[model samples]
Target: MVNKILISFFVRRLPEIRRSKGVTRKEIAKGVGITLGKYDKWEAGKVLPKSEDIARIASFYEMSVDEFLGLTEEESEAIKQKLIEDAERLSPEARKIVVDAMTDKQA
Candidate 1:
């Protein structure tokens, strides 16, 4: 299930990010492989995008999903910590993969 708070944040933040980046809705839609109408609905808060769409949009901005959703620094840190804690319980190989992925994303 999607969190309503995060959805609200995403709705509010997306256009701000786009405007700040000087990009048009049409550009974002084309870049993310979504229709302009769908992007319009998302920007207007008429509907939420699917998770895959959200990820694509974030990637288009070169940001993580959390960053795209306007999560505070503390919230982002907390999520990172939680992921690290969970990864600690995984097998060494699995932990390495998780760490590497995280590192690669940051880079």
Candidate 2:
């Protein structure tokens, strides 16, 4: 199993990947073989995907595990255009979290 890094590593990359796939949350959930709610939690950083599941998601997005975890922003951005799309789907509360993150403000 990959040693878990900060949970944010994977969480931060989700929006980018979503942007790249041209997929909706429903489609991403379906592609990942999980429920939309669960997948949303994963993307929203409320939960972390198991190591293997992370790998699977990386593969589904045609990226490396490192890329999926936001370790490589340039490549990740190129591959994760769909991630920004999903960011819009986050709930109001979730958007606050994202906003705080953007402003370097901690909740």
Candidate 3:
């Protein structure tokens, strides 16, 4: 249920991104090396694009696949909240040390 809703929302985002790029479905299809019908199906939520095709579309739109699908906001926030929770479970000094170690690439 949630998956379907997200996919539908993601499909809707495609056209908005395309218009921002000043391209139509035909233009994006040509840019991404696909059929206009197929691309239209994607935007219409009649078909979900595969990962590779989504990556290609994102590239064509000058955005990452994550951004293209609108995952950057909601998913990123979830991940950040998870990280904060994990950090809180650890000692404060330990948290800073972990961040520093990762930044320093000491591993």
lDDT by residue for model 1 over 1-107, one digit each (tens)? 45676567667788899999999999999999979999998877778875456657777887775667666777867866776887788777656655654454577
Ranking by lDDT: 1, 3, 2
**Whole-model Cα lDDT of every candidate shown, in order:** 0.74, 0.61, 0.67
Best by TM-score: 1
List, residue by residue over 1-107, the lDDT tens digit for candidate 3.
Answer: 96698577867788888888789889899998899999988888888875446656766776654566566566745644554466566666656543442233222
For each candidate, give its TM-score against the true structure.
0.63, 0.54, 0.62
For residues 30-94, write the lDDT of model 2, one tens digit per residue. 88677999888887777887544565576677666554565565665543444345547766655
- What stretches of model 3 exceed 4 Å from their correct place? 73-107
Candidate 1 ranges with C-alpha deviation above 4 Å: 1-7, 72-107
Better of 1 and 2 by lDDT: 1
Off-target runs (Cα >4 Å) in candidate 2 are 1-5, 70-107
Arranged by TM-score with the best first, the candidates are 1, 3, 2
Number of backbone-clashing residue pairs for each candidate, in the order shown: 0, 10, 0
User: What's model 2's overall lDDT?
Assistant: 0.61
